[model samples]
Target chain A: MANSSDKQNRLQRLWTWFWSPAAVLSVGFTLIAGFLAGILFWGGFHWSLEMTNTEEFCVSCHTMETNLGEYRETVHYNNHSGVRAICSDCHVPKEWQHKVQAKIVAVKDVYHEAIGSISTPEKYEERRLKMAAAVWKKMKASDSRECRNCHEFEYMDFTIQERRAAAEHQRAIDTGMTCIDCHQGIAHSLPTGYQEEYQKISEALGVPKLGEEMTFSEAKSDEIRTYLDQ
Target chain B: MLQILGMIGANMLSLPGILGLAFGMMTRKWGFAALGGALIGLLEALLFAKFDFSQIDAIEMVISILIGIIACLVGCAIRRKGVLI
Candidate 1:
């Protein structure tokens, strides 16, 4: 009976300890565990984002296959400098928010695929010019936002470039021309008669046909000169 | 390029589901609120997908449901802690 009473006393003490102020630490422990879990979750999310940004993955879709084939033959993919520019290097923005937005825009291809918009190589060929125009528009609108990721105006040494390239690059800087305005088909296979399509777009937009030597219709006219000279 | 668009198109559905969950909780039937919110959120996200392969869309669906659950929890906590009653 004395042993039983001693056992009861021990049990009572144990319960009291369990209910003591120390129980507050459980909340702290839970919060720390939660913070750790959040870190792991973010790691996994960012990992997936990086994984999909690779060249190999970009070329996996049939839509990208043709462009990839063309890219493989290009100087950017295989050059003496050994500096390679992958699909995302020239395409995807460096900022995470813009990258996310750009990736979001890419989802339209799914709808196009669903409707068999360019299921066949022949269909892609037919739509090439329209597609090129769309890309050019975006590039122009963004002022070659992605290209600046690697090539910045401040970083360019025009003297090192070919004489003609250097002169044109300088001229471009003076006139506010973006990289895509002159560098169409730099990385991709140019569609047949893209020049005509470009011309038509140029006429519609009233901009100089990009990459052409300017035949200025209003060459620094007096009013513009006065405004600028001020 | 299209993938980014898909992400936006797919996730926009969460807005509506979140709305449904918020109002559903007012009914005070938590099981119905949670189940209905999650179901609605998942359904809307799937519908907005525009028929894509949607590798990340499942993530979107789960996020909306989680939002619904969170909203429900918040509503309950407020109801309990505050002098609303």
Candidate 2:
């Protein structure tokens, strides 16, 4: 009889413990589990923004492959100074206002890609030149906003450079020299392939050929000035 | 098989939380501590999901790992101190 009574007491104690505050708290842990699951979902969405750094993302379209290939061969990629700027860094504007404008302009590129308008290499070159001219005009009007981000004019003595440049500019103006006649390779390094292309195009356009091999040297460059004067 | 492994690796973010819960259950500590760790792990995973592999390189990954390890160590130390108290 006493053994049966002790067993009943033990059962009652166990039942009470099951309904205790500790048991309720343990059940509440389920809500925490749900909250943790929510965080994992949030992190996954953030990963997509990182793809801009990858070469694949930059050259997913075949249209970019030529320029990207050229860029890879340039001093920017070769010197390993680790300061490499991709197409967007130079072409796109820095400020939010300009960024939105650039994005809006990019719609045309998407449309062109969709329509397969850029078929041959020649057509690609024409399209690229057109786009480059548009970008150059925008940058020039804005005093090269993207360039100024890295190369600040304030650091250089513009007064002395400007004076010298003005004298050269006036001489060029007097001699009817085109801007490219003097400052052909200001933004990018001059490639031999581009020089050959320039010669071909000049011949096709009925322009007089620059006889001597063109280089960055002052003596070689003075010949270009004299040629422009003629 | 490689693809399956990649998928499994990608989905392994929940492992830390599961391990934390298991540890709590084994030690008879506040079960909520384990739940909290799991919640933190989930939050970390969610935050990580927002960043694409291009944006978050190896450096960012290392920083995040360091953060997780430090948080876990701090939590464990506090728990140990609480037991002593």
Candidate 3:
């Protein structure tokens, strides 16, 4: 009983000191140690982050196997010059701050995987449009930052490019149109029904190319109605 | 586990607070439990919501923090009132 009492007292004393004002030095040392440990931890973590930027790591997730297969067919993956771009080159930012932000946003992808949101190719297809839209939106917002990392207008040898390609590039420069504006399918297959979706959006927003509404003649309208009914 | 915590923070309105309170009551350390809950809630919110102060809904965060504190106090009261469990 005496030994038990002594042990309890020692434990109580240690607890008191742990919570006491006198433990400021102890707290300071702990904080310093923790900070040092954090540096080591986050350093290793950042290294792992960069390693995951590889094509191999990116495709390790079966969710991306289809994308990887598609990517392999792209010029970015292989060409006469033999220079190649990996998954991170296009999908992740080059700069650290932006990369971290992208990764934070990407945590949702991890969460989706955890929740089995796209556990199969069919499931991925079901959400492909939404996913494509999200990537498009991000690229538009960033002015295709990732694409600019490699294909820059300043360095492009337009003279060597085909006339149409040169004209389009010049036009894009003149109009401030970014790479993703027209080049979304450069890496992956365009989601199914993309044209229909784009047309609906344009119609909803009253695209300027479309003139004022034209009314059909009663006979034409009746014919169209009959066609629709059929 | 961080993912789970993040999901919990994202999906539940008051579950984090309740969890903290329950932990506090069980451990008989309501204040520390509440603080821990607040930290977890805040971290989870930032991680899962992908929200910084510049992007977050301040009202929602305040509500989460308040929930933690209130639940902890309730837990403390329960402990003090002799329901030791």
Better of 1 and 2 by lDDT: 1
lDDT of 3 by residue, A1-230 (tens): 99999999999998766545543468678779989997998789779889878888877776888888888887888888999999899989886535655665678878887887888988988998888877776676566889999889999999998675676678667656667655656778778775454334334533222232212121133343343233
RMSD per candidate (Å) reads 15.0, 19.5, 12.5
lDDT of each: 0.64, 0.50, 0.65
The per-candidate TM-score of the B chain, in the order shown, comes to 0.53, 0.40, 0.57
The DockQ leader among the candidates is 1
- Residue-wise lDDT of candidate 2 within A23-127, one digit each (tens)? 345645856876788677656643542344356776788777666776776554555477877666666666532453455556666787778767567777656
CAPRI grade of model 1: incorrect
Score chain A of model 3 by TM-score against the reference chain A.
0.70
Candidate 1's residue-wise lDDT over A1-230, tens digit each?
99999999999998766545543568679679978997898688778878878998787776777888887877778888999999988877775545665677766766786787887899989998898887776676566777887788789888797675676678777776667656667778778776666556555554435443432312322233243223
Judged by TM-score, which candidate is best?
Answer: 1
Order of the predicted models by TM-score, top scorer first? 1, 3, 2
In candidate 3 the C-alpha lDDT for residue A61 amounts to 73
Task: Report lDDT (Cα) of residue A179, candidate 2.
Answer: 41
Q: Judging by TM-score, tell me the better candidate of 1 and 3.
A: 1
C-alpha displacement of A200 in model 3, angstroms?
A: 7.8
TM-score of each: 0.59, 0.38, 0.55
Q: Which tens-of-lDDT digit does each residue in B20-69 have in candidate 2?
A: 43344333344455455545554454465454544333432443343344
